[model samples]
Target: TPTTIPYVYAAEEDRCAPRHDVLIPSRMRFTGSTSFSVNVFNISLAGFACDALLQIHRGTRCWLTLPGLGALEASVVHHNNEGLGCAFENMLNPAVLDRYVAHYPVPETEELEA
Candidate 1:
């Protein structure tokens, strides 16, 4: 049997705006021209977290082009083997972010059926 560990929230978690878990697909390109596809795991007015194959160094500036949302400048804040965390250079408009989050894309099959 495998042991399960409990989860813990960070002390400063409440200081930041609430992060909403979403699966927004996007492309990220670094200043050096390195680019990769990333799935935005969560987003907030301040920043977002994404999972990507490449290893990005902290403080490296990048731009994310979200599907519905336009490109936004951001900086790498932290990273791990699985992905990197980033902070937007400018905070996103809450209304715009919320609208994008609420809009769900229709499946290809559903589109064909309709």
Candidate 2:
């Protein structure tokens, strides 16, 4: 098993799962409803953050569809100007996460020495 680094959250609600920042495109839909395009910004074995301007209630059941994968069941955790944050009903596999990170990596600042 790959080791995961824990990220500290707000004092009130803390999250420990390792979070990988990416820009993977996806589709989202409320339970048994229609789906729309979304972009996943950050993902983990536990949850993911997207650019979906969800005006739904927190804890609303929803499904997230990623390319090469079927609908993944999750629920609305929160939403802000940054977009919607959701938690998966079942923890995602680490290997699966590795694939996404391999494709879309967190942007890094580059310094050139000339």
Candidate 3:
């Protein structure tokens, strides 16, 4: 059986903000690491989940640059072998999140793991 990597200590009930599924290309820079391209598969006012090939640990500071937006600051809250979940230092604007959902549509036929 595959070992499950536990996320940071927040309980499931703590995730009250709605999550929007999207497949948007963006840039991310982890502290002490250079910027790289990343695919933000899901997002919310508080955080986002993205594809991260690099090995990262919890509490890693990072900045994500979404299309048409400045780099949104966040910290790595959790990570598994394939991806990372990051919490924003400041909540994202709801209006911006709405625009992103409108711009990027994850093809319903394409089933994303996250």
Candidate 4:
């Protein structure tokens, strides 16, 4: 029988605000550089996690352009094979974040039906 290893979250996880999983298509640009399209996997009032192909290192600052919300400044805190985690310079309003997440878009095909 194969044994499974339990996943352990980092100590920093305790300091983070509650996060909500959402698939919001967005763009990210390194400070003073061209923007690259990326997918925001999850978000919270504090910050967001995105999947990007660029080699963004920890402590790098960037801007995230969310679908409904405008650009917001953030700093990279960590990165792994999956993607990078960032912390917002200014926290987002909880109400606004909830609204956006609740109404996150559906595929065009699905939208057409509704």
Candidate 5:
């Protein structure tokens, strides 16, 4: 089993609203309104650590897409009062991940893991 890595970072003073996107996957069930709040936090070459406000249970398989990055499949690996944590089902888009890394460079040390 892939190890679940806890995201380690400081919460921004401003809520830094997460970008929302509509997702339509044929494999998954959905109602009239289907969307999820995606937080792009602590992104790395391996994967990104995000918190999602989704009505999905753990182990649920779904596809995710960001503004610059295209759609990719993912599985629900973690869920808590905070939100959901999912390891990208595949290696992240390197180009997109690189851009994010350039923008939100990791600090010298990891902040308290959330």
Candidate 6:
């Protein structure tokens, strides 16, 4: 199996957020209930990335519903053939995101631990 990167991808300026694909539903509710199947490509302290079939225009506001994380308000920061980058505008529960991150733990080795 391929190893997963723990850190979120970022540009040099760290302005735009990065993304990834989880193929899981980041259930969203903006105009209505839309379940989008996406993989979280990257994540930062601010936002994350996911494969979106919908063309997410810049500055578009949407809600994200994680499996256990509940819902969060997010905005489209960037989009391309890869996916849409979104920044968390309002988190229904911060702990939800926290727990999700914690669930995907990167193994610690002696050299890395040192």
User: What would the TM-scores of all predictions be?
Assistant: 0.72, 0.79, 0.82, 0.75, 0.52, 0.59
Report how far off residue 85 is in candidate 1 (Å).
Answer: 0.7
Cα lDDT, model 3, residue 114: 33
| lDDT for each candidate structure | 0.72, 0.79, 0.81, 0.75, 0.47, 0.58
What's model 2's lDDT at 69?
Answer: 93
Residue 58 error, candidate 2, Å = 0.9
Q: Model 3, 5-101: lDDT tens per residue?
A: 4333342238857888888999999778888999998998888889986667777789999998999888888778658888887888889989998
Q: Rank the candidates by TM-score, best first.
A: 3, 2, 4, 1, 6, 5
Task: Give the lDDT of residue 58 in candidate 3.
Answer: 70
Q: On residues 37-111, what C-alpha lDDT tens digit does candidate 5 reach at each position? A: 565554444334465655566556666666555566666655666555455556565666555655554343533
Clashing pairs in 2: none
lDDT of 4 by residue, 1-114 (tens): 987531112213654578877778888989789988888877887777788755667668899998777889888877877687888878889888888788774456745664
Higher-lDDT candidate of 2 and 5: 2
CA lDDT for candidate 4? 0.75
Question: What's model 1's TM-score?
Answer: 0.72
- Model 3 TM-score on a 0 to 1 scale: 0.82
Task: Answer with 3 or 6, whichever has the higher TM-score.
Answer: 3
Q: Candidate 2 lDDT (Cα, whole model)?
A: 0.79
lDDT of 1 by residue, 15-55 (tens): 26677766778899998787679888777777878887567
Q: What is the lDDT of candidate 3?
A: 0.81
Off by over 4 Å in 1: 1-15, 104-114
**Residue runs of model 2 more than 4 Å from their true location after superposition:** 1-12, 106-114
Cα misplacement distance, residue 84 of candidate 5 (Å) = 1.0
